[model samples]
Target: MMYTQEQNREVEKVMKAFADYIRDTQHFDLLWSDKVGYVFLDGISEEHDDFCMAPIILRDGETLCEEIIYHIACDVMEEKGKSHDLRLCGPVEREEIQKRLLPYLRQLPEYEHLVEGLFEK
Candidate 1:
């Protein structure tokens, strides 16, 4: 799917914000509950299910929550969804995510190596 120029800009902005957040903490907890089909970061736990484990992705998700960036981007896209456009959904394809997200993350030194293994072969 091709994103509009504005959509691309928003995605970049949100990803940069997340990168800044991670840089500040040097740690993040991303949790997903298959039972609830809910993926969220640390603070939203109270509103959701018991997300005990990190998401299992093609990579070692426990250490690299790169999927979280995609999920959060999907949410942002969904909010910006137009009446004429398809509603953005969860589990955005790994390739699509890597295309849209990785470049911004790679710009940050700390995230350069961390996101390397996030994609599947």
Candidate 2:
């Protein structure tokens, strides 16, 4: 879960790029969908299912989509760790840690990469 300053910056850059892409290209309110298992860059309605409304922005201007995606990516990476203590920490702790690390992770350039990977088959 510990990330370097450089990695932090990378996450931020990627997040910003993603937000910009959504704003300029997609032009719809992007939100996270747990059903589809990735962030969707479009508006939602009452009919949508299995989706969680996400915060769109942080005080520092980072997007929530990027933060969530980064957190998921980190979770995926950490899942591979061969330590009982780490595995025992569980998804709850992973989510909590992601929330706590939002500020630093928002600054990472890999944010976009993580998001992009979400849609890759």
TM-score of each: 0.29, 0.23
Candidate 1 off by > 4 Å:
1-16, 19-49, 54-94
Runs in model 2 lying further than 4 Å from the true structure: 1-12, 16-50, 61-66, 73-121
lDDT of each prediction vs. the true structure? 0.42, 0.44
RMSD of each: 14.1, 13.6
RMSD of 1: 14.1
- Candidate 2 per-residue lDDT, tens place, 1-121, comes to 2335654454445555455444553223443343432243333444644334443423232344444454444444465562323334456655554554455446564343444433342
Per-model clash counts, in order, read 0, 9
lDDT of candidate 1 at residue 34, scale 0 to 100: 47
Error in Å for residue 16 of model 2: 5.3
